[model samples]
Target chain A: MSELEQRGVPEETRTEIMEATFRAVSEHGYAGLRMRDIGEEMEKTRQIIHYHYDGKYDLLANFLEYIIEQYEGSVEVERDVPPCEELDIRIRQCLFGPGFEEFDHWERMKVYHELFTHAQNDERHREIFDEHHRRLRDSITQVVAEGIERGDFRDTDPERTAQLITDVIHAARERKLSLGHDDAPEEAVQAIDEFVVDSLIVDE
Target chain B: MSELEQRGVPEETRTEIMEATFRAVSEHGYAGLRMRDIGEEMEKTRQIIHYHYDGKYDLLANFLEYIIEQYEGSVEVERDVPPCEELDIRIRQCLFGPGFEEFDHWERMKVYHELFTHAQNDERHREIFDEHHRRLRDSITQVVAEGIERGDFRDTDPERTAQLITDVIHAARERKLSLGHDDAPEEAVQAIDEFVVDSLIVDE
Candidate 1:
């Protein structure tokens, strides 16, 4: 059972609170975030939010976990989807999907990046952020390994190649976050399609 | 005259203050940074530091400018260094350089990342961070253009290739900042050297 389940929080209530936290982060950029602000966004009293969370840190930590769960759920491959296509879809979601343009999605990603940067100094933040990286990178690595086993890709180091693809997608997102204008999923797709995926193509 | 020069601050005094800012940022990260802490680091009063900078934001804005200047100075190619080799060296410096391992350098970078995350919501921070990206990308673009002009590289789009390389270096740094365990610049260097630089190499 998940933390929310163990705490007896209904999934609907948990999601509403998460959305409220998202709004708070969007307005304040994490550094300026306050539990009261989140509570206000949710149309609830701070005490009500406090009942659900230890404080801002605990709420945000669970928010990170919630985000990972949502992402993992989104990227699950269907029976009909080829592993390579699935990988491409995941890259698109990360690099240039509506996530980059939709204000809510963009803000959520920005908050995520903020958390990653903060993790450099804080151990607890590092642990939470690292889990996200491990899950995402491991998922990509598994896809690449499967592709190689299916003879769709050359015998390259699956782990390193996955990391390279992961790095590129992240770099693209970071660029968008920092510079505020970039070729969206197109540049990212091209980079991955040409450099990463193409590099792994097996010769006939 | 430059901002520092117009202020009539002596070069020696400016360097000392910059070093103090670096130390303060290392200890506090940028979000927690206080003018008092920086002044204390320099063994001066807050008023003395204020005489040089308006406040925390102003001081850090100038500090960001100072860092970009330092980085630009470091990446300058020598007259005898080949353009391609010069580019490789720059990648090494950015991605896997001893700079990332040295405590002072690592902390400074962490602070820079913090500033960047803050910039997502702060206009002033965005301006400072954008200048760094523009200068760095422009520098990389120039090298790629030079390589193409000299026939050392194929007729690839220098601008896009430069951005690709820029993304790789940044992604590598972001990975290190988040994961805390990654191949020292070697992985980044290899990714660029093979995927980027090799792709641009002309056939004999």
Candidate 2:
């Protein structure tokens, strides 16, 4: 059982709070978000939220985890899928983001990056972001390694290639969200195809 | 004369205020920063700062411009340097950052990203970031165009190539600073060499 499960917070209640937190953050932003704001987005009162989490920081820390969990969980593919196809899906997902029913991907990413920037000041937040970064790079590396083994990709360092692709996807999202460069995501997809994906594939 | 010059704020005073703002933001962060905190970093009184600027947001808007100006200005190369050399220097400078006497690069970047993230809420800040992003990409695009023109690089869309390189550098720095992945910058350099720079060069 997870720590959250051990704490007696029901899975349904936790997901409700996470969704509320997302709505609140999307509306008020991280700096402006309040328990009251989150409560407004849900049927529960602020007291229940306060009872479960210590304060704003604690709740936000958990929300960050929840957000990462959602993204990580959403990166699904069939077992029969080719390594290159799986790699492409994962890369595009990272760059363009997964579609969420509650909020737009970039909207959630704005809040995510806000918390991400704040991670520099908070140890807990920093650890969470570190884990997220590690998982992202590792997942990509795994796909690249599979591709190499299957003779679909060149004999390159999987870890390094994954890092490059991951960083570009990250940077592209930041460019789009922060700088309002509407074309950054599309441009990044094309660039990845030409530079990264093409370079990784073995010549017939 | 520039708008700053026309505003009657002396160059020396503007630079002093910008430096103090940097130090203050570094200490307290963007969300926590105050005019008083900025005042403490300066030899001049708070009233003097108030006399020159309206409030925290106004001062910060100008400060954002000033930070971009410092970075844009610092990206200098000798007149006769080759396009590839210039591109390499610029890329390394973006990923690793330029040296500054008063503060560390990553430390300052933490503060910069904080503001960049906040740009979403403020139109003025968003415009400033947009212009900075454009300039960074354009300068790189120009270099890539020159390289292709001289047959140093393979024929490719300079704008697209530059966007990819610039985004990776930005992401790598953010990864290093926010996630505390200390090796991110170095790993990015290696990735760029293998994926981007290698792909761009023409084979004899």
Candidate 3:
């Protein structure tokens, strides 16, 4: 069990709070968000939220971990999926994000990036973001390594290639959500296909 | 003269205010920054800052344009430089950022990304960020097109390639500054060299 899970908030209640936090952040933004705002999104009273989490800062710190966990847990593929296909799915998932019942992909990403930007000034938040980056890069590296071992991809530096692909996916999302560049994400996928992915595949 | 220039603030004083804003934002962050904080960073009093700009929001809105202007003006290469060299210099400048006397590149980028995040909620700030993104991508596109015309680059889609390169540079900076992934920027440069730049160059 994760450290956060061990803190005694039940898994279902925690998921509810995370979803409410997402809604609140979507409406109010990171700087302006309040516990009351999150409470309003939830069916429960604000006292319930305060009972579980200490305050706005504490809740947000936990919210950061919660959202990252959601993303980490959301990515699932068939066991029989090939490495090349798996890599493509993972890249697309990062770029487009997974489907959520309450919010669209970009909506969740908007809140995610807001929290991400806040990490610059907050040490705890920065640590969380650093861990997420490391995990993401490492996961992509693993896939690339598997592809190479399977004779499906050209032999290249998997770590560097993963870093490159991860950065591009991140930048494309930032462009789409932050700058309102509607075409940026699709264009990024195409570029990755032509440049990064094509360069990875070996001749049949 | 630009609309901002025509608003009656002298060019030199505007630059000073912009620099002060950068320092204040760097110190206090976007959410915590105040007019007095900016005044403290400047030689002038708080009233001088108040006299020129309406409030913290207005000052920051202008500061967004000011830093973008600084970056736009800072990219200077000799007219005789070839397109490929110019492209390399521009990419490096974006990834590493141009040297500033007051603060280093990442310091400036930290503040820039802070304001960039604020743009998600503010319409005016969003417009400024949008304009900056458009200009950065277009400049890179122009360089790529020139390189192709000169036969220095292969026949690839210049617009798409430029967008890919620009996004990677942005992501690299964000990773380095926000996540404290110190190696991200240099690693991005390496990946671009092998994947993007080498792919651009025509075979001997």
Candidate 4:
């Protein structure tokens, strides 16, 4: 937070504005958000954000840098996923947990999807998406690789397996969004969990 | 083919328009398409198409209905899998082969992706996407259920398995898009196909 502010605004102000920015961007999408709205929410002048970060582009860049930095810093891979007999269950939970059943998850996906659409035409947005995946795959691969070595998983190709698990979660989210409206059918999370778990675990 | 043109222009004319529509819509997306371009390509007046049907709206509707009909009518169930030693390899190819190589797959994906994006606002587009899944899933599920009965597959829940496989492909397409431009990376296709195959098959 200090680093982000030093790069632009004061630490507290930047962090507070960023919280409002994420909340606004996540809910209303990039198109619907306005600097005045964020200022009003945070009880700060729009000029403050502008003076600190240059403009919207700088704000977007700093916001992503801050978020990705925090994402990387907080994900203590070795500590987060402790291993045991319920290894498969833990892996499944980590990937497709009901924890992601939060409303924030859905809105977050919508925001990301909107950016993905724009990324087709904008190089900067595409870079963000690419960086997100590269970091995610690397981090997950480390845990899955370690799990296999510690006898928690089958001696399968960890890189391949990590990508597979990643794709499964990605697919499930798409399914939720596609069928997410009023008339769309609900899918059982446990069934999908089994499908993911059984697909990856050792036959023993 | 015969069924679609029973009410339209000469069968050849209708077929020509539909094929061009698919190529155009699939390549440039539905919103990117123009009725006049389709008319010019067919070398026919809008009046001709209007006389045959209603207009561009009718033409696109008939085209979608036609694809749906063709999908249901002529789906190959792959009965020849025939208890082989290399069952997983064959099954993998069956799920994601032929139409999904580096060729028009991007274009195909583009149209569906466009529909997915617009479906956020358009109920009609969402219905078309859901129906596409329903018919495709029904055909695939029937094949899977029969395989389970025959002791080929592990007697897993057929509908769920169908959903998972479709979801995998859907996600892989998205991941690949996020990673590369135009054609999916060769590595992505191989990785996706191998992961999907590995998950679906029983060891011989």
Candidate 5:
């Protein structure tokens, strides 16, 4: 019975390993990362990894939690729907809002790719993903439905319209990340401005 | 002259290493993969990798080339401006044409992440990413501009509008990947479908 016994893979120790694993996986990815590498990066030992987490899978679940936490904490998560009329505005407000005013697309892009790749093959991973980017799509769909009810949006399918909005948002993030370079400027951001307005505000 | 001192790495041998690296990297990812694994996968020796490619960078370049050949080669690279009407159709045709039709999003998604992350610190890497995607974005903008001039699309800012289109497409791909395990049936794809028709089809 020593420090290892005291620690004995407690929640705190598990969380620390998972957090470090997140960085390693995000920077390197799932395939190349080694137990020793994680230990070295965090200045711990491989036994610590074994002690706190059963193995890679245990560490993966916890790493996924961190990935999803960032998502819910992102500009997209919603607790309650906004008025149908103002959902678009809310979306843009959060996207380019002062809260994320200091956000850097490049730094976040790798973590996104890491989590997203897992989301494809891992069920728990996808839950974490949808948990984050939830409601924006539904809200958009509801907006379309509401518009139809209000006799504003077109008579087309609301659900379909919602998916497109989701698509647009998803696609924009990819382009934004891939296209964001040191040389790229504000003009890049300006280019996609008002996309939501155009997509949804049916021609009068 | 030994293997290194020989005339050069034979093109077939070089191509083999590239092909082997492509398979290895795709399965294990750039960081997770190893030179030894690439050799074993290809049924050759580690020396074969050294003979054909300098190291990881060289393997990555060749892998990138394979991606371009396998993936980019499929895209209809139209450099010239098509007629306005044709251009509009082309935009819809490529993006809305298929959600999962042309390429499996998983492999392409990984390749995308690979190039994008590598581009963070490497100018040449960014250059490759910039060249392919910017061309596609520019193409969409040109179409929007033409539609505006000829009065096909609405009188909106073509530059900004085109970016929005690009963004939505980007977002849609992400949603497809991110929603990999959503309990929702193809509802997400349906939403994107309607959005395309709404976004591109002009009001009569």
Candidate 6:
């Protein structure tokens, strides 16, 4: 439905280039990212990368969108799945999932943090990051609302509860990435599980 | 007494330079920050900034340490005060205190986020960031343990409870900075207050 969806296979090359950019960024940082480094990562000419993107900024903007899409696609709260279970899966994914385990996951998160940090000063980039936040919040809100409706969760403020969960998960992720915390994910899972059980679950 | 404290009032110039760097990064962002822009912000010759620090990277690393020290010095949980009240004050500081309301607050947070994102690949920067995280966590943990000991709060695992509080607060700050959420601070205060009451308060 999106332009990205319509492009299909051609988008694969775009994604490949984005991944290469990600590697360069992970190794050298956003400030240090260079076309030559990206080209070296991709084993292609800078011209080829330039053909796909105007410059580093342009490539990074698209890369931001691409990773957002990839993340959104990875976590699905299915209709048949109990909302509580779905919430667990989502939280676990945020903390201990393969995404957290893999270097690529951490790398992508670092770049995402870079975009977020940059968004504070760049109006154009702010819009992209804002949309990403909206989508992420909406997805979590849906799960919270469904859990309440299914009678799995207590009758509480869905939006506030969802926001709380998001805040905790995000804090954990940020600390882990920036502080080189190996235990953050597990600690997050334990903390969230306890918080949810105490604050959100309906008493039998 | 750290090197910074040892410098005393003579450090006013150091703080001035750091503030100038903050303004430059706040406007142009970390990646775009240049010595010329920093000098222009301070209305000082580039030679002055260069004389104090070797390069942009050196200036930024020192700037990171400066801000971290600044933040650590902001909040204090007094021994004679009721632990619950101390906890309340600390949470409010994280959420809606004047510290969070000032433009300088947002600017500093943005710059701190920049360092965090950059620390992913830079080991030296990572050590600075790691120390910052540890100190923040320890501060929160002390408040939680005191609250529990004084029976101003429920008996709970203080470390885990502290981590939960940190996660939610951090997430709220991150989202506010990146997504342009004007309401995040207030929302965070509400969410965290309610979570504490429900999860940790002992019904008297």
State which candidate has the highest TM-score. 2
Pick the DockQ winner.
2
Residues A19-109, model 3: lDDT tens digits? 9998888887788777789989988777878888889998999999888887888988788789888988998888888898879888888
lDDT of 2 by residue, A46-146 (tens): 68888899898888888898888878888887897998899888888887777888687888888888888888788999998998888999999999999
Clash count list over all predictions: 2, 0, 0, 0, 16, 0
Give, for candidate 3 chain B, the lowest lDDT window spanning 10 residues. B41-50
Cα lDDT listed for each candidate: 0.75, 0.86, 0.87, 0.57, 0.56, 0.75
Q: Which ranges of candidate 1 are over 4 A from the true structure?
A: A97-103, B97-103
- What DockQ was computed for model 6? 0.71
Q: Better model by TM-score, 3 or 5?
A: 3
Residue lDDT tens for model 5, A1-204? 322335455656655675667567655656566776677667556587876666776567666665444444454534544334365554454343324222344445456655565555568777766755666567566666777777555577776655555554445444445555332223333432344334545576
Q: What share of the true interface contacts does each candidate keep?
A: 0.59, 0.89, 0.86, 0.30, 0.55, 0.86
lDDT of 6 at A14: 79
Q: Per-residue lDDT tens digits of candidate 2, residues B1-204?
A: 655778899898998898999999998888867789999999877687888898888899999988888788888778878888888888888766789988878777888888988887888999998888889989989999998999999999999988888888888888877888888888888888899888998987
lDDT of 1 by residue, A87-174 (tens): 8877877664443223455666787788888778767878877777878888889888988998988887787777778877887777
Model 5 in CAPRI terms: which quality?
acceptable
Backbone clash pairs for candidate 1 read A96-A185, B96-B185
Per-residue lDDT over B1-204 for candidate 4, one digit per residue giving the tens place of the 0 to 100 score = 354656646767776676667666754556556777666656556566667767766676677665555434544435566532233333344334435333354554544554565455446656776777776656556666766777666656777766655655566666555555333334344554454334455666
TM-score of every model versus the real structure: 0.91, 0.96, 0.96, 0.69, 0.68, 0.89
The list of candidate 2 runs beyond 4 A from truth reads none
Which 10 consecutive residues of model 6 chain A have the lowest summed lDDT?
A95-104
Which pairs clash (backbone N, Cα, C closer than 3 Å) in model 6? none
Residue-level error in angstroms, candidate 1, position B47: 1.7
Per-candidate chain B TM: 0.90, 0.95, 0.93, 0.68, 0.66, 0.88
Candidate 2: residue B126 Cα off by (Å) = 1.3
The digit string of per-residue lDDT tens for model 6 on B1-204 reads 765556452576886787788788878877767889889887556687777677888778888888788787887666788666776787777665346333467778877777777777678899998887777777778877877887777888888888788778777777788778878888987887777645666677
lDDT by residue (B113-190, candidate 3, tens digit) is 988877877899999888888899899999889999989999999999988988899888888878888888889889
Question: How well does candidate 1 match the true structure, expressed as C-alpha RMSD?
Answer: 2.6
When 2 and 6 are scored with TM-score, the better candidate is 2
